[model samples]
Target chain A: MNTNTQTTRLYHSTLSPFCRKVRLVLAEKKIEVELVEEKYWENPPDLKRRNPAGKLPVLRHRGHMLAESQAIVEYLDEVVADPALMPRQPLDRHEVRRLCAWFDDKFNSEVTQPIMNERVWKKITRSGYPDSRAVKDGLRAIKEHIDYLTTLLEARRWLAGNAISLADFTAAAHFSCLDYISDVDWDRSEAVRDWYATIKSRPAFRSVLADQVPGIHPAPHYAELDFG
Target chain B: MNTNTQTTRLYHSTLSPFCRKVRLVLAEKKIEVELVEEKYWENPPDLKRRNPAGKLPVLRHRGHMLAESQAIVEYLDEVVADPALMPRQPLDRHEVRRLCAWFDDKFNSEVTQPIMNERVWKKITRSGYPDSRAVKDGLRAIKEHIDYLTTLLEARRWLAGNAISLADFTAAAHFSCLDYISDVDWDRSEAVRDWYATIKSRPAFRSVLADQVPGIHPAPHYAELDFG
Candidate 1:
């Protein structure tokens, strides 16, 4: 069994939205973590050892190995109660989780996964060249997603509700990854742009903003807090 | 706004593992619910109105709309705490969630989705014919998954631990769907077979046992309590 310690460490991939969500939550809760980037696609022996499921964003804290980005983020929020990432009411909490799934599951399949697979993973993993059709489809899908998010933001202060919750972090994580590759059209939705700018300027986003993926340059405004 | 009543209604599909999971949880909690079968692929007008994500397994309770199977199940466990689906300790709870994700995300992708897409959805949705390669791949993947689950059962009575938690229900949900199409080769792993038999015998599983998708038939042993 791994010994318990005050230290927290996360095994992650820099460009993964799932990993970024965990990082953002940890940062928001003021938890210090040592980030170790793992090349999970190569079937690293330690990766499966750390998480039996062999997934990224495996967090080792207080002698427990936590996997599943949503589960880990919720655990972090529970353990660190001062800045709660989930709302108090059950109905409101359901909304937070529902939206989290929207981004992690739906948005990812529709936009982030396909786009990254075509433009990013192909280059990083030495796979075939980008498929223009897949990229075009992802770009097209993202517009509808942005419009949906714009509608959500127009009513609520944050994605889930009035408070800044894990849903915002989850959505931002996916958006940031697409933004890194300059796939997002900032001119598309003013509401979404404003929401992004507000979240991007937070202290929790600093480390993510500083992410430097090898051989793939970030967009010029990727790290700029005042991009809006 | 929908009127609040004593009624708890679930909008779901027969073959969906996610819907099965919610059914199992609600039944375990002894919450009486009305199951409404929905053709989500057809994108019925009320589907999006009920839940903006337009996903199945949307539970309507006390006039609150709940989407995302995991979120709904968790909410049910929280609100109806008599037969708690989640463990008490954070570590144990994390393990439960991790295993839940294991079955829901990894196992679903590698086994259920591929197999179901080929065998079931194509027939129901009138899409292309089943790809033999995809079905073969899903069958091949389930072998390794069964082995893994067998190992976990060797160490612990249940998938997550000694107690039957949401992980067990989540896993059984997926397995039940595959079993419905007579896809599972239960003879491969005695341990997994025993686990399924144990979960399947529970009273909560009765409704799922009685499920009959149109034009598709359940295996002979699907509803048998003494299948083991």
Candidate 2:
């Protein structure tokens, strides 16, 4: 593997879906990097300087620094020469980005927000009681997003296209976190469920699945579900 | 140019920030296409078929289609080869995406929302009277966002790096809409004020800047402010 494996540092958290997406991309690209776990809540000045938006998953490559998941993925795709995670054509690539944005924006807001906020943020932010209404809303939204995913999976082998792209990694990253809280109904959408199983079983995703978020315990089915 | 040109169609509204971002990208890339102005408030089935999320600025590239401003801009960047709107480095690109997301998510929510809702949405959505409180809040937030951009512009020639990237376009797109309502204080931050002026002067931006939203009239300073 001639991929650039020099002192690339990924400042990420074990539980963040965005960080997990970058980690998955790095693994698939066959690049090795030092993963630095970030305490985003602590409001570290160095991390804040690295990302003014003060979000997780800031990547340091060579001397340049970057702060968004999609941008980081695109940069990785560009800097490395092999195993493309993005498509070559304009439209096909658009489809990949569209799905990636879908997961980042809508799915994160709808499905992941409720579950993560309830299960993780409650323990992390350490504020307010876990409202049942938000939890129910998130659960309901997750089901709908999964149905949409199922529709995509039925027509395409992968989430966005024939081969595994950044889109699949992004979706699985979000769902995996929700799965940690047991918010997702795995049986609800078989096609999407099956697609996720395959993505989870990938060698690239091993570290992400194995990541332990301190006080939280992943749902029991998290380890049992098989993609193969 | 060897880049492939498809039957590109943009489903957009002149007033939407997301749509304006796509329009700016098309201008930078110099891509020619049909612009289908969508009346999103009507909930047209055609628009829903293109984007189930019912969002603005859905780009149709030949057989493939994409929703979300970030995704559509990226596709246009790839398909049209001139004037690259994104940086080559992973980290720099991340900064661009992060800022773009900042504008789309934070600025829009914190600043654009209050202004649009109070100013245009009341009229467009036909809900009720625009809230003065929200309008006042939006005005306050816009100034802060401008200051943030001032810091970024102080260090670099463009928002993300030495050259103009999509980050500038995204910012300008938002401000242009705000400028439509005479909401932005152009003199507050000179650097940001100038940056927006640069984009507004572009031939691609002329059409968008010239757009009239029926009953609204822009301040004279909007078209006159200069960054240089």
Candidate 3:
């Protein structure tokens, strides 16, 4: 057990998109953090003590245990000024947040959650066999999401706007998770594929790219910067 | 159809806590909005056009259709400035957002969504009869939440801290929905009940108090300021 209470530590699961978002932001902001993989599925007793909500991606920073990925990332952006993830104008910020919610809530529910539950979690937790129907549904849903992203990319340089904001990282986080399991059809949309390639090459994404979840090997092109 | 595009409009469902949270913030800032009730259950085709995510509480303001309740409220707070709902310090803001997410995500999942799905939506959509077991589960889950709120109230004047912020509104939004159906056991925690009373009596709460959903009458004491 590390006795240093001052050290910024993140309690997270490697494959969880929420945790990965926080990790990416922390890296993007050049903040040093010790990542502690938390098996939230087991209902770790201390998880409740650390966070009343008892959710993952809890950050122990500056004596505060921060929970909720969006809140934590926003806080980091606020505290650390350089390379800001949020935009200046209220409307721009709203666009960023709206997209963040879109990915976190809608995309997660529609694409990530069902597929991850079927493929990754069921295998890791030994819960059950993957439901092909659920996986197929998630795969089908991702096509629409990819099309939407392509449309957005055509209009703006990034998902929310011209600049690469938290929305990009958020969207990338979900895509990366699915990509790890070889679920994403990178060839589906040229623009989305290009966007992912651009974001994937960022230094901030390095830590995430190097992640190794036991028993689940990364897809051949998962960490390839030029893949697809 | 209202031709006044300049007039602010809110596409919402009366019972949705997400929409109600945005409404509370708008009312607190005294932003007059034309309420356009959207029967999202029927999958209004334009809902997708208005908001790609196709969720309700979509606010059409300043010619932009803003989606996501938290994002819209935060944007309102930023643009309005007066009657600020967010705290000053980054830490304080984070606390407010954390609690807001706690209610919106955690509380909604455990308490609001299940109960409303079984008790309210089923009846409204004529989908099926209420499932007593699901309703009971939500009712049971809410007790733990009330207890947690009681603990938080013991330490601070509001849900986040000494000052009233979006956290309070977010929490009150969910509670109000449950309270409408006479689901909340206000007797569980005096502290929580008192908190609700304080928030309920605010002028901003008027429109929400007056809400009347077709085929589903509110509980007799739902609108009473001194209900508990």
Q: Please write out the lDDT profile of model 2 over residues A1-228, one tens digit for every residue.
A: 223545788999888899989999999888877888878788878987887677888887775677778878888888885888888877788888888989988899887877788778888778777888888899888877888888888899998899889999999889888877677788887887788888888888788778777788877777664632
Model 1, position A123, has a per-residue lDDT of 97
- List the candidates ranked by lDDT, beginning with the highest: 3, 1, 2
Cα lDDT tens digits, model 3, B119-147, are: 99998898999888988899899999999
Candidate 1 residue B198 Cα shift, in angstroms, is: 1.2
Full ranking by TM-score: 3, 1, 2
Error of 2 at B97 (Å): 3.1
DockQ (model 3, Cα): 0.93
Q: What TM-score quantifies how close candidate 1 is to the native fold? A: 0.96
Best by DockQ: 3
RMSD of model 1 against the true structure: 2.2
Error of 1 at A183 (Å): 1.4
Candidate 1 or 3, higher DockQ?
Answer: 3
**Which ranges of candidate 2 are over 4 A from the true structure?**
A1-6, A225-228, B1-8, B30-33, B87-92, B224-228
After superposition, the stretches of candidate 3 with alpha carbons farther than 4 Å from their true spots are none
| TM-score, every prediction | 0.96, 0.90, 0.99
lDDT digits (tens) for residues A1-228 of candidate 1: 223455699889999999999999999999989888899889999888888788999998987788999889888887889788899888888889889999999999999999999999999999899999999999999999999998998899999999999999999999999999999999999999999999999999999999999999999999999897
Q: Is candidate 1 or 2 superior in DockQ?
A: 1
Indicate the DockQ of the complex predicted as candidate 1: 0.74
Docking band of candidate 2: medium
TM-score of chain B of each: 0.97, 0.92, 0.98
